[model samples]
Every structure is written in C-alpha cells, then in structure tokens.
Target: MDVSVIGSGYVGTTVAACFADLGHRVVNIDIDEEVVATLEAGEPPIHEAGLPELVATHAGPDSTGRLRATTDYEALLDTDVTFLCLPTPQHADGSIDLSIMEAGAEQLGATLAETGDWHTVVVKSTVVPGSTADVITPAIEEVSGRTAGTDFGIGMNPEFLREGTAVEDFQIPDKVVLGADDERALADMHTVFDPLVDAADAPVVETDTRTAEMIKYANNGFLAAKVSLINDIGNICKEFDIDAYEVADAIGLDDRIGAKFLRSGLGWGGSCFPKDTNAIIHAATEAGYEPAMLKAAVAVNDRQPERFLGLLDEHVGVADRRVAVLGLAFKPGTDDVRNSRAIPVIEGLQARGAEVVAYDPVAVENMRSHFPDIEYASSAAAALEGAHAALAVTGWDEFAALDAAFDTMATPVVIDGRRIIERREGLTYEGLTW
Candidate 1:
C-alpha cells in the first residue's frame, strides 16, 4: 500500500512510522519543514516509546526507504491512500476548532483533482460525529470539483493511540474501525489495515462515518468519566479515612466494572480526555441536551489540583517558600505537557508566592516554554534539594524509588498526586485522594 499521512504531530508521526513498519510505502506530509527534515533523517520528531526504532528501520538511508517525508501536499497525490492525521484542537468555548482539518482537507481535495486514479482519504483525526461526512467530505468536494464515493473515496478511521504507548497501541489495538459509505472505501480501509488486522487478529468494526467518529468520542468520554468517577469516589473514601485502593480492588472483582483507568489521583490531563470531554459537552449543550454525568466528572477533575495544593497547605505556608515539582509531563514516557496536571499545581504554588523548582526526566525542556521563570533541575534530587516541599504530579517509575532524596529537602513534606510514593519515616506524605 502506498500511504501518505498529513500532519507530523504525535499521531501523524506514529501512524506514518507504524504504517511503514507494516510494509506500506509511506510518505509524511507536513507544513513544518523541521518535522519533515527530521523524519527524512530517520529521527522521530516526538518522544514516543518504540517510535524511533520504527522510524529508523523504515525511513532514512540505512533503512528500506519505505518511509519518507515532504512538505508538499501534492506528494499525496502519488499515494493510493491518504490519512488526514491533523489536529482538531479545542476552541475557546470548548468547541472543536476544525480549521486545521478543513485546510488539510481542502488541500488534499485540490491535490486529488490532479490525479485521475481513485484515491481514498481517511480521517484519522479525532473529531465530533458527522464531521467526516458533513465537514470533511464537503470541503474536499468543494475544492476538488469531484464527487465523493465516485471520484474519490472518503472514510473515517479514528486512531486509538495513546501518547507513551502509541506504538504498542497501533500494533495491537483492541479493534480496528472502518467507517465508509461505499463498498470501495470500506475495502480500501481494510486493505490499508490488513497487515495489522492479520498480525493482531483485532476485531473489525464496520460502521458509517458518523458512528465511527462518535465511537472515538464516546470511548474517550467514557474513560474520562470513569477516572473522574473513581476520583470522586476516592475523595469520599478520603473523608471516611478509608483507602481508595482497597475500594477500587474490591470493585475490580466485578465483571461489569473491570478496573482500568481506576487509579484515582490528580485526574487525567492529556490531549485527549480534556479536549474530547469538553468538546462533547459543548456539542451536546448546543443540541439542547445537558450531559450531567460528564459535567460532574469534569468538575471533579478540575478540582483535583486545588485539592492537591490544599493538602500541601496543611503542612506549611508556601508564601515566599521554595517548592519542588517532581514531574512536568502529563504522564511518564512522553514529553507532552499539554494539559498536564503539573500546570495547575505549579500555578497554585505560584499563586501562593512559592518559588517553584521543577524536574522531569524528559519533559523539562518542553515545560520551560510554559514556565520560563521557574527553575528547572537536571535531576529529581536537585529539584528536591533544599526545597521546602515536593509535589509528585506525574507517576514516573523513578519517583517510586526516591526513598533517600526526601531527607535532603528543607521540609520533607511530599504531597503525592499519583500515589507513586511510599510512606517512610523521614518524610511527611499526603495523597491527594488516597
């Protein structure tokens, strides 16, 4: 299969590399020259586990030359299938700003007009239901002057890749969604994902474009709601002087409530959960239906950081004090800081006039852009050194091993958001919602 993927962000790069690894001739199309150059050089533009190896093996001089990158949208015309992996970022009012996806679709439509051969355009970007058929299809048809399902095929194939575990998720997804109106587009989608379908024996979900789009939103929304529910439950457990983990464990025994995303901590703060939940809420409201459960879930998630800071306040005054933030990334294994819980924690610390020192194994550089004035330490120990207190925002594995580092803190008070720390004699530990 000859594949072209647009947008070289996290999802774009991951799918491109993985597609190439699956024996497809892949070309990544992006507006960013640096990202295109980085891909051409066999280097991953983003930090994801198992991505560099895949890129190195399928792209560049030493590899099979099956994967390459270009800044030109016309390059996509040469490919049999094109995947729009663009970003549908959240707007000010929590509605999806589909300008990026629209622009990409217009350009792709124009590019497809140059070719006489049939091409399939798959919307792999996360979007609200009816977007693929209503927004994207119309945009492409308007620009190309070609009809969909006749001149060019359009499909909605949403991606389920997580930030840190994207490669593994792509390789072994629980299900492969194929959404298309016509038989040809459906067969094209199956062909594109045939290698993966055969490799993992993953279930194939055949549905319409709108349903496929809704599936992505519903999946993320449910997971986000689940975490928020547990966090709410954990908050109650804390009031009762009960261990939330024990409650979660007992609930896990029930077949209906399988315990994934059950770990209640600082709450979810990545690109997916917050954006998807807010978008759906906004969309649902506009349609005259209020999603009460999702609204409560978001309320719980939004208050977790404040709850964490309040716990810190119980030990000492943060005003004019130096506090250490143990992690900056949303989660371990990736350098993505978009909507990370650390942002709120740091902001709360700063609001109290606390001089903040932050540390992350790989996300420190990314965080510098968000907080240039805040000091960043090379090591977790360095961040903890002489600090009045420390807050663990991300549950990195290395944080679990920090037994002796607490002794060096000026006030060994640790407010753990992720429950990644253990109680020791020398340190004062407080879980945000244990």
Candidate 2:
C-alpha cells in the first residue's frame, strides 16, 4: 500500500516508519524545510528510543524501496492512504489550535479538487471531538467541491503512542479504533493494519467520526485520572502517615484496577494529558455538560507541581538557596518537554530567587533550549553537588540513584517529587507524599 503521512513530527514520523517497516510504501509530508531536510538526511527531530534506528532501517531504500519523505502536499494526490498526523496544540482558552490540521486538509483538498484522484484520508492526530467532521472535513469539502465519503474516502484513527516507546507502541498497540462512514475505506485500512490487529487481538472498534475523536480524549483523560487518583490517595497517606504505595499495592491486585499508571508522581506532563484533560472538560462545559470529577482531577494534578515547590520553599528557604533539579522530560523514556511539570517548577523556584542546577541524561539539550538561565550539569552527581536542595522532578533512572547523589550534595536536602526516593538514612529527605 502507498501511504502519505502529513506532518512529520513525533507521531507523524513514527507512523511513517512503522507502516514502512510493515511493508508499505510511506511518504511523510511536512511544511518545514529544515525538518524535511533532517529526515531526508536520516535525522529525527525528537529523541524517541528506537525511532532513529527504525527510520534508518526502513526510511531510504528498502528491498523494495518502500519509504520516502517529502515537503510536497501533492504527495497526497498519488497515495492510497493519506494520514493526517499534524499537530493540534492547545489554545489559551483550553481549546485546540487547529490551524495546522486545517492547513493540511485545505492543501490536500485543493490538490484533490484539481486532480480528482479518489484516495483514503486517515486522520491520526490527537484532536477534539467534532474536529474531523466540523472543521477538517468541512474545510476539505468546501475547497474541493466534492463531498467527503463520496469522492474521497475519510477516516479518523487516533494515535496512542507514548513518546519514548513510540516505535514499539506503533506496531503493538492496545487497540485500534477506526472511524469512517465509508465501508470501503474502513476495510482498506484494516487490511493495511491486519498484522497489528491480529498480533494484539485488540478490538478494532468501528465507530462514527465524532466517537473516534472522542476516543483520543477519553483514553488520555482516563490515564490522567488514574495518575491523579493515586496522587490524591497519596495525599490521604500524607494525612495518616501511611504508605500510599502499600495501599495502592493491595488495591491493584484486583484485575479491575490493574496497576499500570497507579504509581504516584508530580502529575502527568507531556504533549498529551494536561491539554487533553482541560480540553475535554472545557469542551464538555461548552456543550452544557460539566464533568465535575474530571475537572477536579485536572485541578488536583495541576496543583501537584506547586505542592512539591512548597516543599522546596520550606526546605531551603527559596529566597537565597541553590536548588538542583533532576530530569526535565515529562517522563523517563523520551526527551520531549512540551508541557513538562518541571518547567513550571523550575520557573517557580527561580521566581523565588533560588539558583537551580538541572540535569537529565537525554533531556539536557532540550531543557537547555528552554532554560538557559539555569545551570546544566555534566552528570546527576554534578547537578546534585553543592546545592541547598535537590528536587527530583522527573523519574529518570539516574535521578533514582538518590544515595550517591545525596552523598555528593552540599546540603543533603533531597525532595522526591515522584516518590522514587526510598527512606534513606543520614540525609535530609523530604518526600512530597510518603
């Protein structure tokens, strides 16, 4: 199958490489000349584990020469499957900025209008409900003068790949929900993804466009809710002086509440959860329905970073203290800090006039771009050395080596934001929730 993936960012790049690995001709289209040039030179924009290797393996010339990338919108006209993997960032009002997605759609529609080539348009971006039909489909149909579902087949397939393990997730996903009104398009996509569907035996739910769009929000919101629920439980442990992990351990035995995302931390922060949760709540409210519990979950998760910052304030007296920040990426596996909680934590600590030394094995360069004012250290020990307090903002493995880091710290003040630090002796350990 010939596939054209639009917008070669994280999801787009991963999607292109995965499909190419699965024996399909893939061409990734992007507007940025620099990004396109990098991919053409076998370079990945973001540091996702296994992505660089996979792209290199399946990117250029294969046994059959399947994979290709381009900056041409006209690539969509020749492909059987056009994947819309464009970015839909969050707007200030808690809605998504759909300009890029719209731009891709308009570009494809114009080409289709001129060429009259019928193709399958699959949307793989994480978009809000009603986005495909209300915004994207309308934009395309208005420009093309040909109805969607008739002249050009349309489908919505949301992406659910975690940043670091995106390559693995792409080939082996938990589920694959295909949204399309056209039966032919749906069946054709299933044929291309038949191997993945069979391997996981995951449900291939066939739903309407709106339901498929809602699935992305629902999946991310539920994951965020689990993290917040455990963190909220951590708050309860703080009150009773009990171990939240022990309580979670006992409860997670039940298959009903399986123990994944149950570990407590400084809340979720990446490209997804924060914006998606707020957007879902906002979209629901705008539609005259208030999701009170989810809204509270968002509020609770949002406050988690500050709660850790407050601990820092009390430990070193933020006015004139040297703070060591370990980890900047939202989670451990990827070097992506789009909405990492560490940003706000670092900014908050700086506003309080504390000197910060930050370090992450892979995220240092990315963090340096965002936080040039702070100190970037050579190693975790270097970051921890000579600081009044060290805050574990990210759960990187090097950060988890608390003892060695504590031994080298000038103040021995360790604040475990993710609860990765066990109870250690001979050190000032202030865990946010024990």
Q: Which stretch of 10 consecutive residues in model 2 shows the poorest summed lDDT?
A: 58-67
For model 1, name the residue pairs that clash. none
Task: Please report the TM-score between candidate 2 and the true structure.
Answer: 0.96
lDDT of 1: 0.93
Q: Evaluated with lDDT, which candidate comes out highest?
A: 1
Q: Residue-wise lDDT of candidate 1 within 80-143, one digit each (tens)?
A: 8999999999999999999999999999988888878899999999999888889999999999
lDDT (CA) for every model shown?
Answer: 0.93, 0.84
Model 2 residue 318 CA deviation (Å) reads 3.4
Best by TM-score: 1
Model 2 steric clash total: 0
Clashing pairs in 2: none
